[model samples]
Target: MSIQLYGLCETHSSEECNFYCRVCMFALCKECKKQHDIFEHEIIRAYKVNEVASFRLADLESLRDASDICPYKGNGRLVEVIYKRGDGIACCHGQGNVVECESCQYRLKSPSAKYCSIQCKVEAVMKMNESESVTNEAKRKVETISEESASDVKSFTKRPRE
Candidate 1:
């Protein structure tokens, strides 16, 4: 299709423009395009959608790399990529930077942070403390029950008390 100059570029609002920012949906001219590029805005030549069609991935991927083009049928653009350092998969609906905690399997907000939340960290500590207490309780109950049984056996051995 042909690129139309609706009016002055959106960036400078004074200079003539031929290109448009796809992400922000703003128009930009040749001179403004250079300045907008520095900011890293995703821009594309505006084209009129004269026709729409239903297609499959096999058809689209064969024409061009699937990664370069959005798999969806209508968008006709590349998928936005968010950078991550770790091998762990992303969290927050595949948008934010998050990694699962090794201890609780919860997603941590920051890649560098260790735990997801204060509660998970607290649960870890409580488990340690609870383990010590639970073991001690079990030992005490065993000793008490054994003593009661031993007393009953001694009473049975004795003759009838007159």
Candidate 2:
């Protein structure tokens, strides 16, 4: 059973098919699978069931009312199937705390994220470095003036008062 023939997605030519849409009877990549999910269409792992008999059995199983539950401890929420990052499923419940990006103030999806995206993170770091450079330049100027004033004071103190 070689799925190499159906490896690439028809719609997304550049992406490889990871899921099979039973209703449409075609293979789908991770991005194209989202539409089928919204329509509540039956979807299965492309590698799991490529044969005609397996598709029929999967459809029969989908007709049941059984639902997938979260595997995390103490969280009994229903699981949402995620195809984008492999076959991993996630629970709907979040930690209740929201993280905002430091530069743009945009809401962050990842819990440990300091910025919303790579662009924002890069911009924030650049600005911080720029300010530090300006501050360093100003400190150098002040130190130079202080050293010149000290030299002048030493010359005045050494001269006898005529």
The models' CA-based lDDT, in order, is 0.48, 0.50
TM-score to native of every candidate shown: 0.25, 0.37
* Separate clash counts for every candidate: 1, 0
- Model 1: pairs clashing at backbone N, Cα or C within 3 Å: 17-29
The digit string of per-residue lDDT tens for model 1 on 27-120 reads: 6677877777646555654322223121234433433322322222235642211111224443455554556654455454446644432233
TM for candidate 1 is: 0.25
Worst ten in a row by lDDT for model 1? 78-87
lDDT string for model 2 (44-130, tens) is 653332221122223334543112211111123222221111122223337468655565555545566465433344456679999
- The whole-model C-alpha lDDT of candidate 2 against the native structure comes to 0.50
